[model samples]
Target chain A: MIEVEALTKRYGSTLAVDDLSFTVRPGLVTGFLGPNGAGKSTTMRMVVGLDHPTSGTATINGRPYAASPAPLREVGALIDAKDVHGGRSARNHLRAVARSNGLPDSRVDTVLGLTGLDAVAGRRIKGFSLGMGQRLGIATALLGDPGVVMFDEPVNGLDPEGILWIRNLLRGLAAEGRTVLVSSHLMSEMAQTADHLIVIGRGRLLADLSMTDFLEQNGRTHVQVKSPRQDDLAPLLRAAGGTVEPDHDVLAVHGLTCEQVGDIAAAHGLALHQLFEQRASLEAAFMDMTRDSVEYGSGSLPPPPDSALPPPPDSPDRPGATEVAP
Target chain B: MTLPASPTANAASPFALDGPVHHPTTLDVVRSEWLKLRTVRSTFWTLAVTVVVMVGFSVLVCAAQVATWDQLTAEEQQANPINGVSSALAGLSLAQLAVVVLGVMVISSEYSTGGIRSTFTAVPRRARVVVGKAVVLGLSTLVVGLVASFVAFFVGQLILATKHFDVALGDPDVLRAVLGSGLYLAACSLFGLGIGLIVRNTGGGVTISVAALFVLPPLTALIPGTVGDQIQKFITSNAGQSVAATGSAPDRLGPWVGYLVFTVWWLVLIGVGTWLVRRRDV
Candidate 1:
C-alpha cells in the first residue's frame, strides 16, 4: 500500500505538487491521472526518495521508501524508460541493478523472459526501439518482485499489442494482491484499465473515487422518445415534472427513467416509434469534470476562412503604396 | 488472446517466490561497481591508451637518449643520469591524461546517460553508492597503473642494459620511484573521479579535470619567481609529480609530502561532490 499525506513540492515560485494526500490500497489497480504538468512525475519521484518533498511524507508499506532495508525489494519503480546505459547490453544492465540489490543473476534472466526481451538480451541498449526501451524499463521494475510497483507513462510509445500486454500485466499485478500505481494522461485508457482513480489538476487533488462512482456521479442519463404524436408527448412529459427538449424529430426527457417514460406514453395511448435511455460515456464525464481544471485550454476558435487578410499593397503593380526609404 | 499466468499468483508474497532475499551490503555495491567499470568499451580504450603511452613511450624516449649518448659532454652526462628509474618512467606526463579521463567517466557517464536514477533507486543510500564507486575506481586504477609502471621501468632499463648502464629494482631509490609512479597515476585517477562527481556532465567534468592537471601548472609558472613557486606547490600535477622523481627539485615538498598534498585536492573535491549529491534532486 502507498500513502501520501500532505505532500508538497515547490520548484521556485511554482508549486509542482501541493498539499496532496491519498492512500492506494492493494488488490486493485489505482490510476494516478492528470494532464501534462500536473505533478504526477514529481509526486512519483518524491515517493521513491529521488526528489525531496518540501513538506509531508510518502510511505510505501507503512515506511518511507529509503528506510527499507531492501528498498528495491519493497518498492519497484519505472520512472523513465531511458535510464539504462546505452553502451551496455540489456542483460548486463539488468545484472548490474540486480547485483546492487543482492538479487541473484537467475532473476535477471527470468525478468528478461517475462518481458519477452530474451531474444535480444545480448544486444546493446542503444539499438533498441522505444517500445523495447519501455519493455526494458518494465523488466527492471519487476527484477526484485517487489510488493509495490509504480510505472510512470508505461505505454507512452508502444504498439497495440504492447499496450494490451501492459494493460493485462497491470491487472495481473493487482490480482496478485500487490499495490499498483500507474500514471497516464489518457482518460479513456484509464477508464478501461484502472479500478480506482486519484485525479489531480494544478498540483491539487480533484477527485479520489472509484471508476463506478465517478461514472455514476458525472455520467448523465436521458430518455429519448420519437413518435408521430411527439408534440402531444412533449406536453405530457412536461406536465409529469420531466424537463423536455425537442430535437429535430424526437423529444428528449430528463429527470425520468426509460420505464417511466414508456408508462406515460402507454397511459396516453400514444404510439411510440422509439423510447430508450442514453447514458453518457465516461470520456465525456471525465472531460466535463476536468474542463475547469485544464491547464492549456484554448479560449476561442480560429477565424473563419473568409477572414484571411488580403495581400499587402507593397507589390510592384501597386508601386504608389510603397513609401520611399528615408 | 490468452493472458499469461500471473507471476505472483501462487506465491504468498514477493520474498516467498524468490526464496530468501539478500539486502545488499556495501561490498556487493562495490562488486557491482567493479563490473560496471570494466564492461564499457570506453574503459577498455582508456586503459589501452594509458598502457601504450606510459610503457611504449618510456621505451622510445630512453632509447633515443642512448642513441645520442656519445654526443653529450661529460658535464651533461653527470648532470642527467640516463640509467635511473626516472628516465624509465618519462612518458607519465602524457599517460596521466588517459587515467584521468577514465576516472571521471566512472561517475559522469552514468549522469550523462540518465543511469544514475536507476543506480540510486536500487541503492538509495547515496553515500554508499559513491563510496563504492570510489573504492572500485581507486583500486583498479592502482592495479593497472602499477602494471603499466613496472612494464615501462623494465623495458626502458632493458634498452639501457645493452649499454651496461641499467639500474635494477635492488638499486637505491629504484623500487620507490617505480612504485611511486604507479601511486601517482592512481591518485590522479581518483582526482578525476572527485572532479567527475562535482560536475556531473562528462564533457565539463573532463575539461575541468584535464585543465587542473595539465594546464594550470604551466600557466601558474608564468607568474614568475617566489609567487609562482608558492602557487605551483599546490597545483595537483606539480605537487604530485615529485612522487616519481628520482631526486628532489628545489622549492618543492619531499616525496611523501607531495603525495599528501595531492591527496588533499581529492578530499576537498570529493567532499563538495558528496554534499551536492545529498542536497540536489536527481
Candidate 2:
C-alpha cells in the first residue's frame, strides 16, 4: 500500500500539488485521473522520493520510500519512458537496475521476455521506437518484482496491441495482491481498467470513489421520447416538471424517469412511438466534473450551468475536501 | 506493432514477491555503475582516444627532438639537455583533454539523456549514486591512465635512446615522474567528473572544465609579480601537472604538495554536487 498524506509541492511561485492526500490500496488498479498540468506526474515523483515534497509525507508500506531496506524490491516506478540511457542496450539497462537492488541477472531476462523485449534486448535503446522504449520502461519497472508498482502515463506511445497488453499486465499485477497505481488523462481508458479512481483538477482532489459509485453519483440520466405528435407532448412533459428539449425527432427529458414519462403520456392520451432511459456515459460525467477545474481550458467557451459545476473549493459540500480514513 | 497474445505469461513466476529482499550496499551500487560505464560506446571511444593521444605525442615529440639534436650548438645542447621523464610524458598535456571529456561525460550524459532519474530511482540515496560513479570512474581511469603512461614512457624512451640521450627508469626521480603522470591523468578525470556533476549538462560541463584546466592556467600568467605566482601555483592544471614534471622549480609548487591541492579541488566540487543532488528535483 502507498499512503500519501497532505502532500504538497511548489515550484517557485506555482503550487503544482496543493495539499493532496490519498491512499492507493492493494489488490486493485487505482486510476489517478487529472487534466493536463494537474500534477499527476509530480505526485508520483514525490511518492518515489524523486522530487522532494514541500510539506507532508509519502510512505510506501508503512515507511518512507528511501527508508526501505531495498527500495526497488519494495516499490518500483516507471515515472518516464524516456528516462533510460539511450546509449545502453536494453539488457544492460535492466542489468544495472537489477544489480542495484541485488537482484539476480536471470531476472533481467525474465522481464525482457515478459515485456516482449527479448528479441531486441541486445539493441541500443536509442534505436528503439517509442513503443519499444515504453516496453523497456515497463521491463525496468518489473525487474525487481516489487510489491507496489506505479506508472505515469504508461500508454503514451503504445500501439493498440501494446495498450491491451499493458491493461492485462496491470490487471494481472493487481490480481496478485500488488498495489498498482496508473495515471492517465483518458477517462475512457480508466473506465475499462480501473476498479477505483482518484480524480484531480487544478492540483486539488475532486473525487475519490469506486468505479460503480463514480458512475452512479456523477453520471446524469435522461429519457428519450419520440412521438408522432411531438409538438403536443413537449408542452405536457415541460408542465409535468421535466426539463424538455427537442432534438430532431425526439424529446430529451431530464429530471424524470422513463416510467413516469410513459405514465404521463398515457394519461394525456398521447401516442408514443419510442421511449427509453439514457444514462450519460462515464466520459461525459468525467468531463462535467472537471470542466471548472481544467488548467488550460479554452477561454472563449461559455461556462457550464451552475448545477453542472462541482461545489466551490471553500464550500463545505465539496467531496474529497477532507481526508477519508482507510 | 504485433505482440504475443500472452506477453505476461511468466509474470507470475518471475515476480515472486514473497522472496526475501536484499538491501543494496555501496558495493552493489559500484557494481551497477561499473556495468553502466562499460556498456556505453562513448566510454570505450574516449578512453581509447586518450591512450592513443598520450602514446602518439610521446613518440612524435621524441622523434622530432632526435631529428634536431645534431643542429643545436654545443652551448645550446648543454643548457637544454634532453630529460627522459619529461620527454616520454610530453603527450600528457593533450591526453588530459580526452580524460576530462570522458570524466564529464560519465555523469553529464545521464543528465542530458534523462537517465539520471532511472539511476536515482534504482538507488534513492542520491549521494550513494554519485559516490558509486566516482568509484567506478576513478578505478577504470586509473587503470587506463597507468597503461597509457607506461607505454608512452617505453616507446618515447626507445626513440630517444636512438640518439643516446635516453634516461633509465632506474635514474633518480624518473620512475616517480612516470607513475605521477598516470596519477595526474586520473586526477584530471575526477576533476572533469566533479565539474560534470555540478553543471549537469555535457556542453556546459565540458566548456567549464576546459576553461578551468586550460584557459584559466594561461590567463593567470598575465597577472604580474608574487600575486600572479601564488595564483598560478594554485590553478588546477598547474598544481596537478607539477606531479608529472621531472624536477622542482623555484616558482612552482612541489610535486606531492601540488597534487594534494589538486585532489582537494575535485573533492570539494563532488561534495557540493552530492548536496545539491539531494535537494534538486529530477
Candidate 3:
C-alpha cells in the first residue's frame, strides 16, 4: 500500500502539486490521470525521494521510501525515459543497478529476457529508440520483482503490439496482488484497463474514487421522443414537471419515466416515429467530471446544435444511470 | 534467492525509491563507479593519451637536450645545470591535461548525459557515491602514472646514453624525482576529479582545470617577487611539479609539501561539491 498525505510541491512560485491525499490499495490497477504539466511527474519524483516535497509526506507500506533497506525489492518505478545513460549497454546498465541491492549477477539476464531485450542486451542505449528505451526502463523497474510497480507514460511511443503487451503485463502484475499505478491521459485506454481512477488537475486532487462510482456520479441521462403531435405532449410534460428541449423534430425530456412518456403520448393520440433512451458513455462521464478541472483549455467555440438530439431521462438511459450496482 | 511472502525490511527501512536499490555499500558504489568510468569510450583514449604523451614527449625532450649537451661551453653548462634524467620525466605539464579530462569525465559525463539521476537513485547517499568514485579513479591513475613516469624516465635515459648523460634510480635525489613525478600526475588527476564534481559540467570543469594547472602558473611567475611566489605556491601545477625537481628552489616548497597543498585543494573542492550534491535537486 502507498499512502500520500497532504503532499504538496512548489517549483518556485508555481504550485506544481497541492494538498494531494490518497491511498493506493493492493491488487488493483489505479489510473492516475492528468494533462501535461499537471504535476504527475513531480508527484512521482517526490514519492521516490528524487525531489524533496515542499510539504507533506509519501510512504510505501507505511514508511518513507528512503528509509527502506532494500528499496529495489519494495517498489519499482519507471518514472520516465530520461533516467538512463545513453552510452552503457542495456545488459551492463541493468547489471549496475542490480548489484546495488545485493542482487546476484544472474538477475540481470532475467530482466533482459523479461523485457524481450535479450536479443539486443549488449547494444548501447544511445542507439535505442524511444520504444526500446522504455523497454530498458521497464526491465530496470522489474529487476527486483517488488510489490509495487508504477509506470509514467509507459505506452508513449509503443507500437500496437507493444501497447497490448504492456497492458496485459500490468494486469498480470496486479492480479498477483501487487499495487499498480499507471498514469496516462488516454481515457479510452484507462477505461478498459484501470480498476480505479485517481484524477487530478491544476496540481490538485479533483476526484479520487473507484471506476464504477465515478461513472455513477458523473454522466447524464435523458429520454428522446419524436411525435407529430409533440406540441400537445409539451403541456403534459410540463404538468409532469419534466424539463423539455426541442431538438429538431423531437422533444428531449428529462425527469420523467419511459412509461409516463408513452402514456402521455398515447393520451394525446400522437403518432410517434421514434421513442428511445440514452445514457452517456464512460468517455463522456470522464469529460464531464474533469471538464472544469481540465488544466489545458482548448477554448474552442461550442458546437452548433444538430437535429439528432440526445434522449430524454424518461427513456431507458435514465435507468442506466439511476440503477446502482450492489 | 527465494521471494519471501512479504519483504521483511524492518528497522527503519531507508532504501525504498519505487525503483533502483539504495544504501549500497561503499564497495558496491565503487564497483559501479569503476564500471561507469571505463564503459565510456572517452576514458580509455584520454588515459592512453596521458601515457603516450608522458612517455613519448619526455623521451623526445630528453633526446633533444642530449643532442646539444656536448656543444654547451663549460661555464654555460654549469649555469644551465643539466639533469637530463629528471627533465625527461618533465612532460607532466602536457600530460596533466589528459588526466584532467579523464577526471572531469568521471563525474561531468553523468550531468551531460542525465545519468546522475540513475546513479543517485541506485545510491542515494551522495557523499559515499563521490568517495567511491574518488577511490577507484585515484588508485587507477596512481598506478598508471607510476608506470608511465617510470617508463618515460628509463626510455629518456637510454636515449641520452651516447651523449654521456644518464640517470640512475639510485642516484642522489633521482629516486625522489622519479617517485615524485608519478605522485604529481596522480594528484593532478584527483585535482581534476574535484573540479569535475564542483563544476558538474564538462566544458566548465575541463576549462578551469586546464587553465589553473597549465595556463596560469607560468604566466603568474612573470609578475615577480611576493605575488609570483604566492601564486606559484598555491598553483597545483607549480607546487605539484616540485616532486620531479632534482633540487628545490628557495621559494618553491619541498616536493611532499607541494603534494599536500595540491591534495588539500582537491579535498576542499570535493567537500563543497558533495554538499551541493546532497542539497540540490538532480
Q: What is the TM-score of each candidate against the true structure?
A: 0.89, 0.91, 0.85
Query: Which runs of model 2 end up more than 4 angstroms from their true locations?
Result: A234-249, A254-277, A302-326, B1-14
| C-alpha lDDT of residue A73 in model 3 | 76
Give one digit per residue, the lDDT tens place, for model 2 in B1-282.
Answer: 211122223455545534445678989999999999999988999899889988998998899999998999999999988887788888888888888898899998888788988998989998889889999998888899999999999999899999888888898888888888889989988999998988888899889999999889989978999999999999998999888887768767899999999999989988887888888877
Candidate 3: deviation at residue A187, Å? 2.3
State which docking tier applies to candidate 2. acceptable
A1-326: candidate 1 lDDT, tens digit per residue: 89999999987777788899999988899999876667788899899998899999999878788777887777789988887789999999999998888888898888898899999999999899999999999999998887789999899899999999999989888888888999987777898899999998778899999988877786678898899999889988888899999887988789888898899989999999999887666655555555565554445543222132221222211111221110
Residue-wise lDDT of candidate 3 within B114-227, one digit each (tens)? 677677665666777899888878888888888888899888888877776787889888888887877877787788888888888889999999998988888877878897
Write one digit per residue (lDDT tens) for candidate 3, span A1-326. 88999999876677778999998988899998865556777777777777788899998888877766667777788876656778889988888877666666677887788789999999999889889988988888887777888888898889988889889888877777788998876666787788899987767898888887866665456788888888888888879889999888988888887788888878777778888886656555555555565554546543233222121112111111122111
Model 3 regions lying over 4 Å from their true place: A219-296, A300-326, B1-23, B222-228
lDDT of each: 0.83, 0.85, 0.77
Expressed as tens digits, the lDDT of each residue in B1-282 for candidate 1 is: 211223464765333244555667898899878788888999889888888888888788888888888899999989976755777898888788899999899888988888888998888888888899989888888888899999999999888887777888997778888888899888888888889988987799889988999988878877888878888887898888778876667867788888899999988888888889877777
Highest TM-score, which number?
A: 2
Fnat values, candidates in order:
0.57, 0.65, 0.30
